[model samples]
Target: MSFTLKPRNGLPYAIATRLPRFPFALILLPMLLAGCEAELNLAAVSQETSHASLRTDHYQALASNEAVSVLVGNDGVVLVSPDQGLTWQRQQLPGKPGLIDVDACPDGSFIALGFDNRLWHSADQGQSWNVHALPTEEQMLTATCAPGGAWWAAGGLTTLLGSQDQGASWDTTSLDEDAMLTTLQFLDADQAVVTGEFGLVFNSTDAGQSWQASGNLPDEFYPHTSHFVSLDEGWVGGLNGFIYHTVDGGQSWQRQDTPSTAPIFNFSANRDGLFAIGDHSSVLHLSGERWQTVPTPNAPVYLRAASSGDDHRLTVAGGRGLLLNLDTRPALAAQAQ
Candidate 1:
């Protein structure tokens, strides 16, 4: 089981623990506490901080718009890069909360999730942030902004949340299920999908007002990353190198061949094309008729988040502050040059 260190009674030195899916993450606890041996430094993370330095923080999610990108993860850490991934500035929330997911809105804003029933918003790329309370404390796992300017999030105990005033308030929905919702995506302004444990898949055409079961993923499947090109077409990747494609809006599935068994973490698309990143430094791109593996600069580490840039580049981030800007052009284009 994985181990996570959460604030104990809002104090720096106190320790709270939880078991997670990825046992490999157990090592990250020591890495997070490396610099400060005396006690946990909560204030050091909350203040307005910026530095052109490499961090050993565990980055979990990402959001982007054009040249601006933000990465958030363990210890309330938020890293912003205005020029794609060329440079970065770091900021942290008060309390060193673990941020699980981040999504960019249609109006150039961003929304990030914390496990403590809180949401953080940034209107100026990542220069600053405002925190708001969510309606439930179910440990929101995934978040996304619809093309129509609505915020949606889901997590444990089949909890679902939606907001219109940018988290000023929220509307909560429960599916009455016992599974954890792990991933979500908006196909457009109206259609959206949510997938999670027990292979559950639910679709909503009338925004978040209603949902209907579409299909079930492979038995016992736990989705970690999902990307939908349309309401009727998408891809979901998970542990053991499993990748499935659904062209009929999740009603049916076709297993796709992946290059490795590394757990997939994130998927993104842009003008250049669609891409996926994960553990083992795995980066895969859609090449014509199949998924092709791409090389990474670092050793195997969990690559958890990615977002496309204006210049046809993909900014990737994950374990131990791993970040990179990858060229998205097809192989043939480089070979012909």
Candidate 2:
């Protein structure tokens, strides 16, 4: 399948072609009351001096924001807030490297996927973790929990795994050859979708027991990645800034006009709309049927993640702990009026 380009903003155009290799603290205070009478005494005392040894700092400290409440990074685990892009804390995961994907479970727990094919569960809001080893080292690419108790994961070189007991044990499913699954979404307990490289898109109706090719994406767009917020609404971002949106199930797709041809690393949407971030410090906003470029105060920051919540708020993170918060309320409200 090929996507025909149409300009939405009359800006300079670039064509995408061909595949290429790619916490809180507490304080205490005391109060004193005066009586009718008081007594005082004076005395002289000598003070003693003692020597103590201090240890040197071993780890480099990094600053982060609150907008990112949960993040899985190559270095470690991080959590942030949505209101302000300030104040961040990091948690260390023992014996784990190359942290890839994180998902906030429905019951307030968190699940993390690592490069070594292990899954970690945190029930105390990411303060501590318990690791569960996978049967294979497939390098998990994406993970999502359904509204029910079921959990699903897709990863390395064409492998799909599902677990009804929440990662304690997994059952593998077959996928098309050369299909490196990048993203997975569960609309309900019995319906889901998965997307990956070389225009591979699959849909399952039986709780992931089986899958078939739902549609053919553009082969020219390599390293294809997609995300679905709900069963009926979803977006896919890939090479050369290619983006495809589906309002119905995977029956049809439409190309979304973008400003940059640089590879779009991530895309996210909420009630406010859609946001895409990528190379060259690029960020694009989707308003109804149009795409607009948003200016960034800081340049040369490689955006790795984008998330949107209610009240027209959006947050982005990348490049040396860079955080950006944007409010699209005025822009969106104006367009609506």
Candidate 3:
């Protein structure tokens, strides 16, 4: 069964663009060598199953930086990939269903949020975790932390929690209207956004201290996952092939046409395009405003979490321990589903 973001509320990936390539001989030389090696060994990239270190339920979230990538699933399963997704070493957690959204913090650490307004911090990646109390009964479906542990979380019943003292104490807030806020992300230390069902979206430009209803989506679209390539360009996906693109930092949004009616579970983008995966092993590509459905392994897999990394590696995780790695491949074609 899908781990519902709320008791019933729905929600939101780690990467959405080619990160600024690192400079310096130590960094640049290794990456260039890796890229060359990957190109020289050109073979059709195939999906490899990564059974989590811990036996758990379905994989739910994926996040990445250049040095590390992490995936989390139900039953408190956490997998850490230091060299992209080539090999994932599982990390033990404290308890079951302990996290929903696991975010790669700016400080090289990680933070995980889950039901009962729970939060966990891991200094050495996900090898270990530590809990901090959140003063709310509602589940914190999605959350993120700025460097030094300034954090924000959003979830069911329009709940919002902020921590300035490294989660030592939480300050609560709420929307006037009732909507299940599913995703909370910070673009920088000063700006962030939260999104939910019925097109509900809130923005905070001043470090998430206060929020203003940015705008609701048309047709009451329910956005499941969102990513920002920059403050200006971004993407969101949801039920029934729904996808939205924003060029003006989400001040406005335009729907991207799609053929697959499968519910869009997650989105991750790079300089070339956005990789959107969802139900029925859906893998759709978006370049500019046009979307092209890419053929995926035919199976019963219901893809959920996705992240794009350096060297054209796109890692996706979903139902039944499904983990597909789309390494550097052909140019995506603009074709129908």
Candidate 4:
């Protein structure tokens, strides 16, 4: 038999079925109330506390500088590892927000983007964070710290956010077109590119002071992730299992074939070279004029973020707390020899 139990405060009603005992409502009333109360009180707890150690946390983003490596993920948790991926200390932001992406700034700091239009900054190598609010209500997709000490973030509806003073204040810019800017990356101090829906490609040469639209990506290709090695050379991965290379600074692109059909989600570079990660444990390494597939221990889980440490190793993070370190020092040594 099934029955409806309406919660207090007009929260909503939950139905229970297949009861074998008498006084079911009476027995479950307090338990339901307690659960509701606990759920309500969960948000009251501050997320600034640090975890005892790193667990299998579902990390969404990873970034690294010369000194530290940082990983951010769901439940507002940030993990910092100073010794590459050897050990980590976990910290959290208040309210347990979901951090989608993180980028290493030029000043040895990191900037992470929250799903709730928030920016989290950690100057002390992801040990602590200062949260800053963006000026828009649109969902932020990516955050980047340029080489010139400028911070930039982009999101839906061509929204571009910038701050020159280390995020003390922010300036908002929206383009004339109606498109979601998915990725904003700076190849140098002043050269950057932004790609988004409708094959949109915008370039900035003056530290984002001005932007110019470049050639459209073919076949309405929507970029899932991008990596630019220089001002005129870059790669963009898409949902259709295709990777496009551009030589003329986004003016045109040529598609590169891959072994996997899963959606490519992220890209990073280390001493081994450029790497891309995506669904179905898809990991690609740029080796000698071709994109080579790299085997992963975990399969079928979407890998979203990757970063390279000062040790020249690449660290990748993904769903279900999946973390993997790709060490190519041996290969580098062999090649050197």
The candidate maximizing TM-score is 1
In candidate 2, clashing pairs total 5
Clashes of each: 0, 5, 0, 0
Alpha carbon lDDT of each predicted model: 0.71, 0.56, 0.66, 0.70
Give me the overall lDDT of model 4.
0.70
- lDDT string for model 1 (113-133, tens) is 876668888898878889888
All candidates in order of TM-score, best leading: 1, 3, 4, 2
Looking at candidate 4, what is the lDDT of residue 336?
36
Best by lDDT: 1
Sliding window of 10 residues with minimal summed lDDT for model 4: 30-39
| Candidate 2 minimal-lDDT segment of 10 residues | 23-32
> If candidate 2 were superposed on the true structure by all CA atoms, what would the RMSD be?
17.5
For candidate 3, give the lDDT of residue 73: 68
Poorest stretch of ten by lDDT in candidate 1: 32-41
| C-alpha RMSD by candidate, in order | 8.5, 17.5, 10.7, 13.4
The pairs that clash in candidate 3 are: none
Query: Model 1 residue 67 lDDT?
Result: 49
Error of 1 at 161 (Å): 0.9
Determine which window of 10 residues in candidate 3 has minimal summed lDDT.
20-29
